[model samples]
Target: MSLKSTVIFLLSLITVMAKAQIDTAKIKSYADQVMVRVNIDTNIERYVFTEGPEDKPLETILSINNKTRASFSVDYKIISGTVSFTPNFLPGNNDNELKGSSSYADFRFRFFPKKIIQTVYYKKVKGFYIENMQDFFPEWKEGKDAYLQFPDLKIQSFGGSTAYVMKKDFSLKSIYTQGEWQKESRGSWVPVIDYDLSIFTDIIDGRKNRDTQYSIGASMGYFYNWVLGKKNRVNIAPNVGLGLGGMFSSTRDILDDGTKSSKENTQYLTIRFATGLHIGYNTDRLLFGGKFNVTSSAYNEKGNQNVQNNNLYGLIYIGYRFPPPGVVKRNYDKIQKKIPIL
Candidate 1:
């Protein structure tokens, strides 16, 4: 054969071998291949395997899988040498099998985070005094120590909080707050020693010394989440927390000379319990939400050492969440019960 003809024959032979290899790969029996089966709403989506071990890093695997399908769920099972994701989810149309009343439908696509989430939020707090005025100053009552009515005190405060989510359901937070008391309609009364006799004295001409306060507190809590919408774009989470700390304040007092004394800095112990409701919309990269919380505190009262200060706070906040780092991601399915240092 001539040189050009020999070269053409060699090329044809190589093409035929490559075609045979492709055909061999395509005709592999299902029984010979491992399978990843997902059953959703009675519709089953099966993924046939090729090689390597069946075990894979779930986070990296999920990170890649989530890019294509927008809505899905995750449940895995390894039975008799078969690795299956039973009750898994897919994008297109799937048969609806299970019917019940639950948030499961809302969370049909369980896209839980495996990374640490850091959140910064600003809150406006309106404080309400719950103790009776007579309980604050009993000596101000004339003759019988009968009830001495005083105008309710209103406190306006603003604060910022930083929180770190250590796990999918648990988190820790720290808060810093500053506030002042709104002027009351009537001035507060103080018992003063005048000419060796105790007499009632007005602290201010109209409104008494406006007490100012600042506080730093630490809290920890757990949240339960519900993912809403067919695409799982809306999320609602409710959480409950308990906190303990103290408040420092500059308060007005009475001197032995029966005159208004200089403001004295005092520290009071505070015990707080709070609950929050969060509602929001989230995409893969961004989240925006509104949070409403109520916190009740019991503090050591300074005015009447015998009575305690009962304080209630109502707070409202709005904030956004950014994408988290991928390196911190973990497979929650494998380590859901493990606890981490907070």
Candidate 2:
């Protein structure tokens, strides 16, 4: 409001704006530039596991950082450090590669040891001019020679596990499900997983179907799957999920037929549970599983709890498996660091 106050406010705003506008190029113009290098490729692939239901496509569920993932495994060597990589990226993964060459490894990757080296160097091959690096790509000034060092990171590699719910879902075909599992005994999949839950909604459902159903309460029960014998690639699996939940059928308005139907369109709570069976269909790390349980939570006319006393409930699901997309290619080089330049 006053002249002095206005000037001070304007100057502060200008200062903040200038700071916000700082760029990589400006940071490269430093009086003293130093670079560090390591003997490994800095850029690598990242993956995570995922889940799916019958309707939506199975996706590698992303973590908090927001990135799709497939699998995780660790790599460790005698003197070499450890790094994490996705199993889908390469066959046998880092551990398999090491196993073939080494007589014995002190630690298995499953142990997930911590031994990342710091301030390592790489072979100096060829590089851009220092003037250009200083003026343009400030991030590329780590090498003393042609081969510039990549930025050092505290995390050497990534290796962990995850859980996924099914997204691309399926419908209930038959009441009973049975088959042989790849790892399980050679016989029928447990048939009639009692208390099986099954969701009986349309295929085109979203928001977990928001704006569509009212306060719904659901729960799930028994499940079953259909596994195949060795002929089906030794582990070809067809999945069936079973569970139950409750969704309010808020569609009791006057129908186009105009029978003045108040069909059970009352507002009810949604509560559902489900059981699912995922089948293994590919050599690649993929899963295609499904559910068929029942959800049994409902609401009264006033959106209050109203679960049916009956055990047969509608089934809903959440999962991390998917059908093997025909053929999958693995980057063998990325898997084995003695990688070939493609």
Highest-lDDT candidate = 1
lDDT of the candidates, in the order given: 0.32, 0.24
List the candidates' TM-scores in order.
Answer: 0.33, 0.19
Q: What does candidate 1 score on TM?
A: 0.33
Tell me the deviation in Å of residue 248 in model 2: 17
| Model 1 stretches with alpha carbons more than 4 Å out | 1-158, 168-208, 253-260, 280-292, 302-342
lDDT of 2 by residue, 1-342 (tens): 863564355445434433433222110111011111111111112122223433642323111111112322221211122222222343322332211111111111211112111112111111111122333344544334232111111111112211121211211111111111233212112222122112222112111111224222222222222224654323322222223334444433333454544445433333332322233332222223322222222223342222232122121112222232233213332443563221
Q: What digit string (tens of lDDT, one per residue) describes model 1 on residues 155-256?
A: 334443444444322211111110001111111111111011111122344534456667666665444334457765564545555677667777674555
Model 1 clash number: 2
lDDT computed for candidate 2: 0.24
Per-residue lDDT value at 233 in model 1:
53
